[model samples]
Target: MSAVPESNWSAGRPDTGLTPEERAAEQHLELLDRVIGLEQQVAELQSTGLLGPSETIAVERNLAAMRSSMTWRAGRLVTLPIRAAKVVKRRILG
Candidate 1:
């Protein structure tokens, strides 16, 4: 029988020999999963019909203002399509 080689285990890494591309893909999937979960939570919050407390409302208004700004809009316009494509690919694969 042929001898099987072993990788070094001195460090604290726990990976099971995933290649770089495979590891990157795994991390990407994890990020996509987090986005999906957060979207679900936001949907649930919206469905509650509670506008939240006054401070929360104020914070949300400030957030909306920030989102509406030209800089933010421009950044979103550039980055969101890439993120959307990744999300779409993940959905299609699943």
Candidate 2:
């Protein structure tokens, strides 16, 4: 039989070879850890109150920049179908 490529294994995974299910479980655990980290950051931010003046200004500038971008406008156009579907579902259900 041909040898399996070493590159298929991720360095972050255990040195012991993992079945496909074990690899997926490891990836899921890693993602959960990252999400927990982000939640802690958001909680810290909430306790500190809203953004500072400079942060607010920076956010506004970034939003203005995105609004003027052609690619951003195209992305909104691309999502129109998904948005319309949600609206249609709400109307039919209500």
Candidate 3:
């Protein structure tokens, strides 16, 4: 008979190693942090009335491009199933 080796739970701890979902979540947080920092800087600049017309147009263009991105479309599609599941659960419980 062959013996199976036991998993080293401590070695595979979440803090030591990340699963795919955990890695993705970490990346999302990092991106969000960067976005927040940029937003804060923009706000500070605007408060000082230093943000020019060119900068405003550039920000708008970047935002429009992001809104039309494949990642944004995919994210919308990915949430559809979750939204459907929530509707089903609510209908069933009610």
Candidate 4:
């Protein structure tokens, strides 16, 4: 049998072998950081109040467009898994 490479092993690293809970905690912290950053941006925008009514409306419209685009992309991502499952199911059931 070939010897295992040292670089390929994690014999003693606790942090390297994270449990599901630890992985979830790390993801939660990352998401929290993003939320905090968005909050800061909203606060800054509120404080400035620089844009005129028409400009604000235009900004709102642009934001809506961006949100729609993001939703479309997210839907596509979710649909990919569904499509793959359908193909697999068809192959299995036929």
All models: lDDT?
0.77, 0.82, 0.77, 0.77
> Which RMSD values do the candidates have, in order?
16.0, 10.8, 17.5, 16.4
* Model 2: per-residue Cα lDDT over 1-94, one tens digit each: 2333335346566776878998788777766877888898889888995888999999999999999899999999999999999999999999
Q: Rank the candidates by TM-score, best first.
A: 2, 1, 4, 3
> Could you give candidate 1's per-residue lDDT for residues 10-88 as a string of tens digits?
2356665777787677667766877888898999988896755987889899999999999999998899989999999
lDDT of 2 at 54: 96
Candidate 2, run of 10 with poorest lDDT: 1-10
TM-score of 4: 0.39
What TM value does model 2 have?
0.47
Q: Pick by TM-score: which candidate is best?
A: 2
Candidate 3 lDDT over 1-94, as tens digits, reads 2232334333566677767787677667766877888898889877895557999999999999998999998998999999999999999998
Scored against the true structure, residue 64 in model 1 reaches a CA lDDT of: 96
Q: Which ranges in model 2 have alpha carbons more than 4 Å from their true place?
A: 1-45
Could you estimate the TM-score for every candidate? 0.40, 0.47, 0.37, 0.39
Cα TM-score of candidate 1 = 0.40
| Model 4 pairs whose backbones collide | none
